[model samples]
Target: MLSEVYPFQETAEAARRVQLNDHLGELGVLCLAPSPGLGVTDATLRSRIGEDRITSLMAA
Candidate 1:
């Protein structure tokens, strides 16, 4: 369920980790979640789109 909402990409692991961490960080701060738990983890969100395109999304 969480993975469906935040899928992952097949990009380099480093790049994926950085982008995912940033995205989850932003979402965590926005939602004020204690932490990026099962609701927001690499495995949980390793299939969603637009996660790598966070620069554009954040600017907007």
Candidate 2:
């Protein structure tokens, strides 16, 4: 896995960079590389899969 000094913070920053592109079009700051290491959390999966042990989602 790739790592960076900053991860999600920079990933979100990269999104903002896209926003910046609109103004920097002539300045040519395209293709800003978002740092690797954007990660998934257990909470992230829990949102989709349902975390309750009593009535959790089941697969057929």
Candidate 3:
């Protein structure tokens, strides 16, 4: 189930890590965007369109 919502802090931490690595690129920093192996279907995303927050986030 996708009931477990990930908090914003986790996303912030990931961004912070990426920025840190990018800033220290002289140390041979490398980044790879591999598939997450899990994703919400288009139907599921469409279903969330009515939700104001979800819609706003999607728009952003």
Candidate lDDT scores, in order, read 0.35, 0.37, 0.36
lDDT of 1 by residue, 1-60 (tens): 122122233235435555767443322122322333433345445456445632322211
Which wins on lDDT, candidate 2 or candidate 3? Answer: 2
What are the per-model C-alpha RMSD values against the true structure? 15.1, 13.5, 12.1
lDDT (Cα, tens digit) per residue for candidate 2, span 1-60: 111133444456655655776333222112332422223346766577665542311111
Worst 10 residues of 1 by lDDT: 1-10
Candidate 3 lDDT by residue in tens digits, 1-60: 211222343555545656776433222111221223233446776577644434211100
Give the least accurate 10-residue stretch of model 3, judged by summed lDDT. 25-34
Best by lDDT, which number?
2
| TM-score for each model | 0.20, 0.22, 0.26
The C-alpha stretches of model 3 lying farther than 4 A from their native spots are: 1-8, 22-36, 41-60
Cα distance off (Å), candidate 2, residue 53: 38
Q: Superposing every Cα of model 2 onto the true structure, what RMSD results?
A: 13.5
Can you give the lDDT of residue 55 in candidate 3? 22
Worst 10-residue lDDT window, candidate 2: 24-33
- Total backbone clashes of candidate 3, pairs 3 or more residues apart or in separate chains: 0
